[model samples]
Target: MLALFAVSLLWAFSFGLIKGELTGIPPALVAFIRLGFCFILFMPLALMAKKYRPNLRLVLLGSIQFGVMYLAYIASYQYLPGYLVAVFTIFTPLYVMLFDALLTKRFNAVLLLPVLLSILATAIIVFKMPDSGQVLTGFAILQLANLAFAFGQVAYKHYSVTLDSPHKVNMASMYLGAMLLTALAALPQTIGSDIVISQRQWAVLVYLGLIASGLGFFLWNLGARQVSAPLLAIMNNAYVPLAVLLALTLFNENADITRLAVGGGLIIISLYWAQQITQRLENKVD
Candidate 1:
């Protein structure tokens, strides 16, 4: 849980960085560079580990989680406004719970309460109705991204428990998979394009690639492995309000302080409620 919170805080600045610094860059190119950094950071460690080999499952999981999710998410911006994208992302918590239930073949109705609360809280902070006539294409694309991300978290949490190797070893295979997918997606975008990156953009990309995408994801998955599905679901949205708050303060973006306070308070309550429910469940099992 601490890992999750830490990653949330770490990721809070990413929104501002991307929106502020990396605006003209192609999304696939950005994703490729980021995942490339992840691969570079983890692959060597994996190779040095004794008796290490690639895990196909982790590769596939990474492809879906990081690769597909990034592509789909970036593509959605073509059809939807940024605010709509944020609004649509609030559904991710529900998708997380749904995927977990489906994969585990156990649905605890009690856990749904916190998940719903988290969604409601996030919606309060970010939700805005679309003024455009048709946004179904973007909505579908964003949902696909959400589903991929949600499934990846649930699947990795369930699958990582059976692994005997260190998580970083497996992360190498995952990043490799992501790198391949994003590289393929970015190929056409970069070919014959006079893509000039400023020094500042390069620095931002490096930070996003190394710290946010690499370390942040590693910690988030580590935290996911330690928590229940419901808690994991709730934690999915925990960063939304924080990101908004950071944008308001640091980036000079205007936001409703009252909404932030109210929604943020509800998010905290949902987290507390989830912790209590999780403890009770563990006690029952014990």
Candidate 2:
């Protein structure tokens, strides 16, 4: 849970960071920097750690999971506002939960109701993402990109847990993904403003690439192996309050929202209720 919190913040800030860094560098180029740094750092580390290298099938799987999927998400922010991108990203857990239930043959439609509500509340809270002027076209392109990213996430949920070790798979996936992103970035830019960064911005980039992404994956995959998919799925909802609350203080310091408080209370209560129900169901079936 602590891991999830830290990782979520890291992820939450990434949208803004990426947007800020997109001043003079190409979006693809900035993406390549992020992934490439991870890959460069991990390649030798993976070799040293039990000489880990992925097999062909695992490589292909990781390509979709880490490579194309990530590019799709990052590229979308180019077209849409960062907040809108994050809202769409909240759907990731819902999609993965549905697929995980089907794959594991453990459907829990009753308990998933709370999660559905969480998604609804989150969507409402983060509505009307800033357009920077362009409205429909930008939002539509981002949604399309998010859809592709969601499919990739489903692909990841199927394979992420099967890996023998998260560290092994984590590094291996990044190595291959970095290579792919670097190649893709070589093409001429077709859209989005170029991303440029100052020295301070570079620090954020390192934290994002290393701590947020690299260590985040390591911890998430580790926890995912130990917990139920549904249990872990709920953590996805936590990101909303976490991001909103943090940004509220950091940006405007407007910590006076009666309705938001009520919604938050409802979400927390429902989450606990759903967990208890899920546990009861599991025990009954067991």
Candidate 3:
């Protein structure tokens, strides 16, 4: 579990890598290139887990995740700083929370109160960043990315439960879905002037494809098999806060922590409280 948490951190902190790597490439090309590597990596794993019938539905869900969600994330970061994008990642749990309520057919408005607070805190935090007035554009791009990611998440939360054994599942197929869909979506940009990427960009492309998308998805899926949803959500969402500090320390970017830190802290507190309440209710039902 701790290792899984570290994996999430690795995924989170790699914003520096993306920022470094994307400098030489276009967003679609970066996404397609990365997914291409991920497809290759997932091939062996999918073969090894051949006996377990692939869940086509989940694969489609993963496709939406990559094609729509991840594509938007990469493109947004091209305009926005990586930190802003990371900050939006924190809101993933909000999608999970809403999905849980809708799927369970329960109205836990109290629990969602925290979720709302968290969103508000995150907004204030981003607003407070010291970006020499360059953040407005970044902020807009990031908001679009967030909307894209949310759409993907909504699809996942709705469809993921259809898989009979998500706990100990064939994660390879899920990634394969993403890999194929992202490739298809990315095909349009592969032609024309945007197709040619330099060597430095290629290095970055390989890293994003192999490490971030390929290995990262592999690790995350395997980790999910060993952990619970809430645990995974929390681990993944930790990136939100760590990202601010990562930006400041890593890229020497100036981000005002005063508002975001305090607001985000409160939001985390509310999120945890909501988690506890929801968990207790679930325990009672179970």
Name the best candidate (by TM-score).
1
Model 3, TM vs. native: 0.75
Model 2 regions lying over 4 Å from their true place: 129-166, 190-197, 253-256
Cα RMSD (angstroms) for every candidate in the order listed: 1.2, 3.8, 4.2
TM-score for candidate 2, residues paired by index:
0.79
Model 1, stretches more than 4 Å misplaced? none
The full ranking of all candidates by lDDT, starting with the best, is 1, 3, 2
Best by lDDT: 1
TM-scores for every candidate against the unseen true structure: 0.97, 0.79, 0.75
Question: Model 1, 229-282: lDDT tens per residue?
Answer: 888998889999999999988999989888889999999999999889989998
Higher-TM-score candidate of 1 and 3? 1
Off by over 4 Å in 3: 1-4, 52-54, 77-91, 128-169, 219-236, 260-264
Candidate 1 lowest-lDDT run of ten: 126-135
Clash pairs for candidate 3:
34-209
Worst 10 residues of 3 by lDDT: 227-236
